[model samples]
Target: MRKIPNNGNLKMTKVAYPMGLFVCLFIYIAYIKWHWASATQAFFSITEAAAGARRGQQAQGPLGTTAHGHKVFYGIMFDAGSTGTRVHVFQFTWQPGETPTLTHETFKALQPGLSAYADDVEKSTPGIQELLDVAKQDIPFDFWKATPLVLKATAGLRLLPGEKAQNLLQKVKEVFKASPFLVGDDCVSIMNGTDEGISAWITVNFLIGSLKTAGSSSVGMLDLGGGSTQITFLPRVQGTLQTSPPGYLTSLQIFNRTYKLYSYSYLGLGLMSARLAILGGVEGKPAEDGKELVSPCLSPSFKGEWEHAEITYRISGQKAAVNLHQLCASRVSEILQNKVHRTEEVKDVDFYAFSYYYDLAANVGFIDAEKGGSLVVGDFEIAAKYVCRTVENQPQSNPFMCMDLTYISLLLQNFGFPENKVLKLTRKIDSVETSWALGAIFHYIDSLNRQKSWAT
Candidate 1:
């Protein structure tokens, strides 16, 4: 390079170097400022990527609204049942009062076919896919990475043909990634639907001595489903309170306290009604003729056990009377003699009053009667009260497996229970969030990130 000229006796000019560097530094800082800004702060950043973040902040569109009053999390949940599939979608959020309480955006039922093992998994996939697509369209917001679809299978899955079950699950997994959870509806219902969240937590705490499980020491919970029923129990805990919510304002809970509990999933409560229809002895019987069969106590004044009984029933949408007391006595007698569980342990437990109709009745919808004059069977919510003489006679037993699956163990762990001690509680809430599935999916997705992990 040829020197243009010796300026001021070869003194170097600072302008060229400093001026160029200043321009470069200005550009570099601008770039860093733009790209380094957090997604939450992208609006203030001047980078192109920051602009991309700002796109998520566009003012409420003509027909759309922000979920967090900012961004939204749209998610899917399925109540897979034997008779049909119920799908629900929601925008997960915890900004209470900021957004409308979740209403079922979409409730769809897909009926493929009837079999213990569903042979129509392939056929059902399209319905589910359609439902999913509709869910995306209905959510109104596009940000949903935080809320993944929660897929659960209730009792119907067991009846599904093995190949069909595997294929359906595989398809769901492929479509939803590791986010799909195939769980029992009973599990999902209690976790999400009833006051079961508090109930489960209370029971778990009572068992560990962190809370009290006392009183009649007879804690029980009954959850009825379309295909089955679950009964759980531990020691009952009683407390006296003057102020509480409307229902508990002056109420008694059966399983007020928790203990090492037991949970039994019966495959035949609601399904049995439908299944019995196929049996000749149960459904093929002749209808009652006009000739009345009168006995010595048929008179109104009769005081016999089965006589002078009045039954309240609805037929063809009309409420009518039948011999309910007789019907109840007969039903009770059958249950007392029937073998629900074969194990000596289960068989030995005292027969508490039947919480058949009321216990968890709402989980499943009302059962309908058949055309052949079949008895309309619904899950009766009843709480049985009985002395456990036979159970006491047997050897002491450990808690049931279902009790080990509760969220209490995790809460206890968070509460400083050693891992060993926590494990003793026999439950590990599936990844804090899993414990809250379809029923609580929205709530958990909205709150999980904010919750401090126990270990942390």
Candidate 2:
């Protein structure tokens, strides 16, 4: 190597040093590329997850777990009715690709209704906030932001003037916005008469497990609220759909099924409203010169004060020799004449009547107050005649018993329910109240999910 080194050895050494350097450079570059790619993938994954959360694509995990490892959720619905405002806090659970299960329901009610504050919209805030507190107490802290909160006004706000109703709703929206729960632009609204009927229909069918299966025998819903009465049934006969009056047939979509139902809400035909009408008093208006309202439905010896729609009136029975049921029936017939559209299809459908129907039936021993029962349309008539005779001979505790029974009996007949037609009366089904609140909330959640899907 010292003198005249071999030419092949020198050449080999020179090439080997550069080749080694090039190999080291390639390895370093490859290491850097691998780390950068991994970091970029991680960043995108986090970004996508955050975006999904923002879109209400909630994480599926054990955070709010139930039996079968189902994820739990909640919905808060405020039913602003003519008589009162009720809050329904519902805890629901569901697994992937399944219908939600109603695990628990917490309900609270406050009196005098939101419409009581129509003149003073600000006064409605306290009651709404109180109900919201009930929801907060029932639902977990983690679900506050995830839960859907809504308030639906029924006939109470529907009867109000447009401007007044809007003001009250706006006040409610303000309170909802300040709360931690999820709120939307359409959170507070007055449900139209048809929608009210459809919602109750949904509630009854859903609670009975009919909505879970296709082609299941579905029952009709009859809800007699204070200010309105609803009759809703799924029509199986083509004659019903073709013969139904305009505004009576409505389409309801739920759980991926479309239903064309025979539904109608008769305003001013509810128990309370009918009482006012039968007594010859105008709604939302005081009697002229503070006069008294006399009706044959009351006892001739009875004289008292009756308050309706925040107005008190002196009411008395007419000094007539006619039968109480006879006179009251005639008067109720007058009120109902041409007011309701009769349907023969109702005769064949199984019906569940609630609200005032349940209250009246329970009051008269027709059904158990807690458990509820069934009654024939004729049962109401018989109860009416019996109660009428009793009221005629004695001072009754409930002065309107005779009148209410007669109205209900005649109301059913008018709706084409024969005397033998059986109706199941209940205030609750499966420990949950049989009201429009549950159904309305379900529909709302469904719509929200649909909207989110569309956006994505």
Lowest lDDT 10-residue stretch of candidate 2: 54-63
Q: Give one digit per residue, the lDDT tens place, for model 2 in 1-456.
A: 578779899999999999999999999999999999987656445433542332223333212443355666788999999989999999887675766789899999999899899899898888899999999888766567778899999988888889999999999999999999989899889998888888889888989999987899999999998999999999999999999988888888878788999999988888888899999999989999999999989887789999888889999988863688898899899999999888888889999999888988998898999999999999999999998888866656899899999999999999999999999998888888999889999889878877776999
Instruction: Report each candidate's C-alpha RMSD, comma-separated, in the order given.
Output: 16.8, 6.8
Candidate 1 residue lDDT tens string, 1-456 = 985877864445656777789999999999888776664354233222321443433222111223325443455676565565556665432232343233334555576422222444455656666666666665533333333466666555654446766666665555555323322222222122223323333333333333322343332333434445444444232221221123322121321222344444545333333222211112222224412222211122222121110111111100221442232233333432342332222222221111122221212222221111111111121101111111123311311111111111221222222332201111122212112123334333433433433336
Candidate 1 achieves a global lDDT of: 0.34
| Candidate 1 displacement at residue 180 in angstroms | 14
Q: Which stretches of candidate 2 lie over 4 Å from their true place?
A: 1-69
Error of 1 at 227 (Å): 2.4
TM-score, every prediction: 0.45, 0.86
Q: Which stretches of candidate 1 lie over 4 Å from their true place?
A: 1-19, 31-72, 96-104, 113-117, 161-163, 175-222, 231-264, 273-456
